[model samples]
Every structure is written in C-alpha cells, then in structure tokens.
Target: MEHEMRAEYEEGVEPGPDAEVKNWHMVRRDGIKAMCGRMLSESAATQPADRWGEPEGEPFCFLCGAVYLREVP
Candidate 1:
C-alpha cells in the first residue's frame, strides 16, 4: 500500500516540497480527509468533529511526553 501510494504521488505531482509535504501529510492524516482534498480540507474537517467524544483514558503527547486526562469538574 505504501509503495502504491508513493507511486501515485510520484507520477501525479511535481517533485518538490509541496508534493513531499502533501505525501507525508496524507500518510499521517489517515482517513480524515483522504477523499475530499488537501491538508487545508483536513484542517477544516477538524472543527466540528474535534470534540465528538472524550478520551476514554489519558492521552499522551508523543513528542513531549505530557499526559492529559479528562479534567474533572
């Protein structure tokens, strides 16, 4: 799947930051907006659905290792 996906980008777009960025972005973005458009489209899709539900457990930042759980009121 990864190879095929890469081929699609290689043949369909220019070889530069835009293509690579979009390719990497799509890989990480998952199915959030694979069918609609570009990263901007994914950003727009995030607004309403961003708070659909609470995390069942604590969520951790992959980079800083910070943990966030549901804040109790």
Candidate 2:
C-alpha cells in the first residue's frame, strides 16, 4: 500500500521568532511515509533493490529508529 506524499508548508511553522508554529507538516522530511506496523523490515532479502522508488540510502525513523521497505499494493 503506497501513499502519495504531499506536504503543506506553513509560513510560521519552522520555530521562527513567531508564536504560531504548527507541529506536524509532512514531518517525515525523509524516510517512510507510513509505518503500517511493518517497521524495520528493510534488510529482508525477499525484495530487491530495483523495486525501490527512491534511491537506496540510510533512511531510518527519527522517532522510533525503524527502517521500512517499499511494497506498493
């Protein structure tokens, strides 16, 4: 199940000198778009590299330290 990621940038959300900083904004600037309870399944050999939409890199979940493999449904 692949999801098309979209980010809505807010003007004062980057912890600027203003007080109206929104918390979440496509926060996963990089890495998996959805967790799907399938965290850290990256190193598994069942899937090959050519299938990845993004070039392979060290993408890890910043909050939980999980790596996800892309498997579009």
TM-score of each: 0.15, 0.19
Worst 10 residues of 1 by lDDT: 64-73
lDDT of 1 at 65: 18
lDDT of 2 at 37: 35
Global lDDT scores for all candidate models: 0.24, 0.27
Q: Which residue runs does candidate 1 get wrong by more than 4 Å?
A: 1-8, 12-22, 26-36, 39-73
Judging by lDDT against the true structure, name the best candidate. 2
Clashes of 1: 0
Instruction: List pairs with backbone clashes in candidate 2.
Output: none
The residue-by-residue lDDT of candidate 2 on 18-71, one tens digit each, is 423221111122333324332221211122323234323123222222233333
Residue 43 lDDT in model 1? 26
